[model samples]
Target chain A: MGDLLRRCLMKRTDPDAPQKRRRGAAVALWGVMALLVLWALFNLRAIGDAFVQFHAFLAYRFIRRALIVGMLVSLCASLLGVTLVLKRYSMIGDGLSHVGFGALTVAMALGFVTSEGLPAFLPQGLRGAVARLCAGIAANPLPFTLVIVVVCAFLLLRISEHSRMRGDSAIALISTSALAVGVIVTSMTSGMNVDVYNYMFGSILAMSTSDVYVSVTLSAVVLVLFALFYPRIFAVTFDEMFARATGVRAGGYNMLIALLTAMTVVVGMRMMGTLLISSLIIFPALSSMRLFSSFRAVTISSAIISVACFALGMLLSCVYSLPTGAGIVAINLVVFIAFSAIDATR
Target chain B: MALIAIQDVTIAFEGTVAVDRVSFEVARGDYLVIVGENGSGKSTLMRAMLGLVKPRSGRIVYGDGLEKNRIGYLPQQTAAQRDFPASVEEVVLSGCVNRMGTRFFYNRADREKALGNMKLLDVERLRKKSYRTLSGGQQQRALLARALCATDAMLLLDEPVTGLDPNAAAEFYEVIRSLNRDHGVTVVMVSHDLSGAMRDAGKVLVMNRGMDFFGSLEDYRTRFAEGMVKGHG
Candidate 1:
């Protein structure tokens, strides 16, 4: 009786282990989210009465938009990322992320971002004034920046296309170069921008309504594409020779993968803050696979876990004045460490 | 009908030629085994014919109704794939992916075919087991079932019996023989084992970096033990 009780108390992490822990963690995670929503609702009077009621409502809309967009982008990145990591293409993911950072940096300095691109969400007078101001003082070369990022991505992708070098190595080189360029460009344009820090680590609370639509639509397309090309992706991920033999054309599939990675990375730059977005892509896949078997299960579980964490992380940021991106990562790390420990003990 | 025809094939990696102007033709219901020592280009030639490796110069022509979803290839198992987390059903189902083309979902027929192939291979009970958890013989059988899903036209095995015990190897060859004799599927396999590989193979092609001979298995056996026995030095 004593031994049986000890065994019962000890963790059992077989196939059902994931479902059990997953349910518990999910409940706890969402419980926190519920509390956060309630707390935010609780503080509604404070926000509405003090601030420009417009700004408060605007902030609320922005958070909602950011939540939608951030989750969608993270979902896209994660789906592609699981395969890429399995094929040892994390470096490529990294490089594409740098490409995103490069794009963001340029957009901040030279693009119509003097709040000009702020959509119709802002009043017309402020929008027009910001646009005109952007036209005047913007020093970052927007088109050139986009061009540079593209060339860098293509060059790395092209080299990795033929050679057997792991795509990660090429990604590492390009991403590093991009980050340095981003830093240099930022320093050069200090007097010209409003929030370099915001670009570095996304201020999710600052997102606009239009961003949500863009995220939802783009992410849905990515999910559909993955489903459509599951065979090609699975084949290439596991064995290239066998995959080719089965009629998965290599060149086209490889390029499409690169393109998807780029799109997800770029779209996520605003929410994850270019530096940490890939973690969102990677963590859930690894965590899901820790107990699940099917790729479908892993992918779905990843999305579910990601959305949950993001929601909780955002709420935590709102309540405690924590960095949103960092807070999300922290929560993810804690979950990862907790599960890993549980797995280890068992 | 000749299922596979390769002519004047030359393969080089970097600057070293692995298969020099090798050529062969395989017919329906034929079981042809190519045997050679290590670095003798058996796998290179096999891959070249399957379009896995592009020969420096060669043409591989397949008969009509036999080019698409008609060739099932089994490459040597590397440690990486053996440890992959997958189900036997999932592994076998991938074979039918070629037939799915650009479609998003595989229908019931494909699933039944995958299941039927696993059952035929006598591995139906192993369907739910993690692919990595299976033994070598089981893994090979699972892979064979996967290939069987893609086509009944031709099954190509690259050193399938290399790591198996004699009984497992014999059992595997029996499946190959049945696949050919019973189903009219053509079989092309690469082998380094002399005695076992020759059991059911109707024709034998011997080579060491080039064509050695193409003749009946009995002829190769009778001609065996000569320095360039069957012209495969």
Candidate 2:
């Protein structure tokens, strides 16, 4: 037992062993990948026909918008997920999504009240400003929800860092309260209850043009920032303390991550619903992690996996009339399991 | 002048003092080893020097080329940290982040420095390998190579050999000794391996929540010899 342990723990002095094994594994993996690609090529006609059927639907414009937004959101979420999951802050996504739900509920309620009730206590200018802001939110709830989610994300990070509260406890406290507030706000608003429910369960067909525009613009910003600061983010994710010691400004990078995560969560809520959106952030990264070791490889592979999963899920939802959010999460689960099994065999 | 001067520094966590009124100076090319039992604040003192922990009172002043973010650091690692999804090259290259300044990307010079340091640490072969898959000693060497990429002036290691087997620990010590003796890089290491540290260190700082002794290794041995024997007995 002792000898076996020693042999396993010690460095392999035979340098050629690892190289030969790695070469063999690489060849096998590439062969399997080529076969899969060939199979996909053979089914191209069937796949094209399925997409043609999808385009024939009257609500295809909204579905198309949802697909674009979903793919962008998935890419951003998976990129950010690698850092967050490794840092043990995966639950921050769940907490912030709940906060977004509350924000959406409050925004809708305020929009309803501003349009219906004349709020006699306010002055003319104040009322005009409030009415304009409420009108903007009524047109698209994402901006309002983005503000609240960003604030909550910052607060969550601060509380977890400075206070005695652990990350899990903080996430629980914030999420439960936000969920309660959302429920209360939804109950209070009578006419817009359906809209709140739509946001809660996600209706791709209900996404407005403005929502798609906002999602694309914000997601592009996230992707650009992520690319620009890739080195710093890598340093921060791996060893925050050492990054700080090396003058990486780890706090700034952390704040950037939280902000990007908030944007992804808020934007994704339109397609995946607030309740299920975090799965988009958690699943793809975890799935890719099972098969990849390096940070770059895992991040890129996760992004690809996320986009593929979203596309498949959207197809499944369109064909079976299932909830888009749940469909995407289900596909992600299947992919995660498959990847885990493959990793176990290795 | 000393490369770093700690004048009555105190470090606290949430208003509770972890290190109290500790003063020390590290001259250029000096190998200063800080030895103490657990909870003795050796790590805290090192953190203060690196500016990772703010001194609750007093100040740490730098002289010559030594400044904040100009020293290499190898922090203590946990199991989760060891499993970070990064290649050895990526990990080593990140040490150049401070030198990149306002630049967002690493330049050719930074890559060259990283490569040179990896070669220096004998980890150039494992450059493309995943860091998590490396053995304990190899991981430490990779991390040490990362630290070397940060600066040529000094290195501040926090309990660098905590989990290594006896042979690996000895090998690690020799590598550190070479860096100090041959490469002329000053080292301030926090360690529990008092005897191993004393073998290479020019100065020794013993602590128990505060500075118990600070002097040459011979002086430490002579001053604490009786107490050590008594404790052993």
Candidate 3:
């Protein structure tokens, strides 16, 4: 590790430095990506058998849903991660995921129960309708959590922009406060249930059928918005003030980024959990940056790296009985280290 | 008509006056240099012209078919851009963003204009290079090309040569001088290197939180040169 650090910090005086190193790094990165694909191809049947052993009923459908949603969310996270990391807004992703967790907890507390604890003066017919509505919300808390998290994301953006507090400090203040609310609400209402534990650490079983639909729709929206506004995002990320002077509406784009980030976090947190979803937005971008020097290269490779990492991690978790979120994070960390080592040697 | 008219501009930030009631006009094909000490509101005034900041009690009237966003600008380098991962072409192409309003991507015309500006700035060879890999002068030239892609009417440069070596600074000045003389472009530069910056200017505005002196270069040389020399020495 010390030697790697020295290699990273020291400037190489090779006669053919930039081009040679750039090519070498690209080769190393693509080699790893190709290896992941070949490995997945070779172990396809084994992985499928392991999934069936892990879950009996609807195992194939569950695995398919997880792959589709997980890969899409990871792609969105990595693409947006390039801009977020570049602008030093990675912590904003972290904060929003925590906010998502908090909102989910609140949603669970508010919606997971029936309308039984209502005031005694309720009418009979109205009481039945209310009870039915409560049951619907109890079954699916995603919409409630989505609304709350999106609002908090915008609030965080405004606070960071207008307040005297630094960006990270504002994030810390809001995230920690939301976390406390979530914990207190959990202790008082839910009393540490498996559902709450699943949301905190993530489990494949946590994904409802409705979650797959929301994740797919929201991920598609994110991908479309990102593609449509790629140039503006690049201009804004490069020099916001300059972009503003050129009439790019930098503030509006910033709001757009915040909105997209909130959506991505809420959807991704279903499988990655609140504690580890942020890694989906951080590791791939950082690793891609280590090996690529151009924005387009970094962005494209980051997306590929993220999807590959998610797929591999999901497979490993299925075969080995490891937690899905931790497994994905471990795979991402390994890729990051591999890229860094290649970069150091180059 | 003047290209840009600054009428009694007063700007304040958080209750502190950064630019007092200052006024100036930039005519077409004119080369104007604003000289000032630190905190003298030079940059603030320029930003107000660019519509990045609003004046407390004034207006910047644009004429000669000039709009706020049409003017080219070469702003000071920020720390974020020092290690940014963008090709020179990408950075240069972004200068045409204002004109591509509501359009998702740059059109063929924008590409041609970017290439023309890159060639004009002698950075066409480095267009494919990463922006962060260029030398300081080359980076400045790349940014200048980007600015040129925005408009041919005027250029607003803020401290363009602050950290450049003397030779590179001279080359940059020559490029600007050619742009003003040969291409008939209006140039407004903010600088502290009074000696080198004042040499090719037709007018000089000496700023000290307001308009201290606004007149021709000859008048400035006669009236303010000795005082400035003594002050600095």
TM-score for each candidate, following the candidate numbering: 0.79, 0.89, 0.88
For all the candidates, what are their Cα RMSDs to the real structure?
8.9, 5.4, 5.7
Candidate 3 lDDT over B1-233, as tens digits, reads 99999999999999999999998899999999998889999999999999999999988999998999999999999987888888999999999999897899889999999999999999999888889989899999999999998888999999999899999999999999999999999999999888788889999987888888898998888775566644421
Ranking of predictions according to DockQ: 2, 3, 1
Give per-residue CA lDDT, model 2, range A112-216, as digits (tens): 645235677767778778788887786667778898999999999998788887879989999999989988887877545667777788878766777778779
For candidate 2, write residues B135-205 as lDDT tens digits. Answer: 99999999999899898899999999989999999999999999999999999999887777778889988
For candidate 1, the per-residue lDDT at A346 reads 40
Candidate 3 lDDT, tens digit per residue, A1-346?
9987777777575546877877777677667767876997999998688767656532578877887888988998998899999988899999998888888777777665554677668876787787777666566777777788889888988888888889899999999998888898899987889877877888876666777887788788888888888888998998887788888899998888888888888888978888999999999999998888888999999999999999888877777878899999999987886787677666
Stretch of 10 with least lDDT, candidate 3 chain A: A50-59
Q: Model 1, range A227-336, lDDT digits (tens) per residue?
A: 88886677666666677788877667777777767666666765677777778777776766665566566667777777777766766666556777887888777656
The full ranking of all candidates by lDDT, starting with the best, is: 3, 2, 1
lDDT of 2 at B164: 96
Span of ten consecutive residues with least summed lDDT in model 2 chain A:
A109-118
lDDT of 3 at A144: 74
**All DockQ scores:** 0.44, 0.76, 0.72
- Worst lDDT window (10 residues) for model 1 chain A? A137-146
Local accuracy by lDDT, each model: 0.74, 0.86, 0.87
Stretches of model 1 off by over 4 angstroms after superposition: A1-59, A106-155, A164-166, A191-194, A341-346, B13-16, B78-80, B162-170, B229-233
